[model samples]
Target: MAESKTNAMRLLDKSQIPYETLNYDHEDGQIHGTAVAEKIGRPQESVFKTLVAHQSGQISQICVFVIPVAEELDLKKAAKAAGAKKIEMLPVKDLLKWTGYIRGGCSPVGMKKLYPTFIDASAEGLKIIAVSAGRIGTQMELNPQQLAEQVKAVFFPLTKEA
Candidate 1:
């Protein structure tokens, strides 16, 4: 397992959050989110992708968004939910520095900073959702609500129809 995945597993255990780890052979340049779902035999809609965004303006606060792989993040909705006037996707370099995970491997659980987290409303009814366990080849399956509670995340309708 990769260091990032190991770190994530350690965090989840320490948090006492019930989760199951999955692994697969990661393909180069493939979208990790969809790849994870396919490997786990779950629908892509139940797999979430972690994205980093920043409030617009100089020295704006950074935010992390977790939404289903099949849906698109509505920045306007996310900004409104976050109480920020505007929002923009953070560059990969900054995302790595802030989250300590590179693009395609960013997980909301064990970030360098505890940014405000938002989960797409669609995840509410699901018993378990898949999220990157800080690596391309691994994923974590856990209760969506519990996951949100663990991160103090706020749920919002920030996703567009898949």
Candidate 2:
């Protein structure tokens, strides 16, 4: 059976941005980023996760952040990067409503709208990084710069230290 193309994959193709699709088994129900990385045989640091947040007191002021799955987003830094005095993760129930993606399948590439996306600065040093392909069990790997360019995302120190 052939896998179908996701919105993220289609968008990447239309933009002529080179990317490679990596698929994994999701039936086990271990869809978290770290488990996904292990299933895909990639380092956790190379597999990033997409998170959606909104400026405090303003649901309309939404933004996206991409960070290594193993790391946590520094809310303060994320807020600063997004120019919000305070930032809060969008409620899990609202994720699909806001980004047209559900948990474990959200990709920064092709969201409902482009909303001030940012990638962790650490990704800038990596040759390649993987993000969800807008579908569960699938991922896309490409140069960090190319991804940033495609999504108009800036690189920033959005993650917290261990």
The prediction achieving the highest TM-score against the true structure is: 2
Predicted candidate 1 versus true structure: per-residue lDDT over 114-143, tens digit per residue:
789999888998999989888767788899
* Position 6, candidate 2: lDDT: 95
* Candidate of highest lDDT: 2
Q: Taking the candidates one at a time, how many backbone clashes does each contain?
A: 0, 0
| Tens-digit per-residue lDDT, 30-129, candidate 2 | 9999999999999998999999999998998999999999999999999989988999999999999999999999999889899999999999999999
lDDT of each: 0.83, 0.94
List the candidate 1 regions with Cα displacement exceeding 4 Å. 1-5
Q: Model 2, stretches more than 4 Å misplaced?
A: none
TM-score of each: 0.91, 0.98
RMSD of every prediction: 2.1, 0.8
User: Where is the poorest 10-residue window by lDDT in model 2?
Assistant: 1-10
User: How many residue pairs clash in model 1?
Assistant: 0
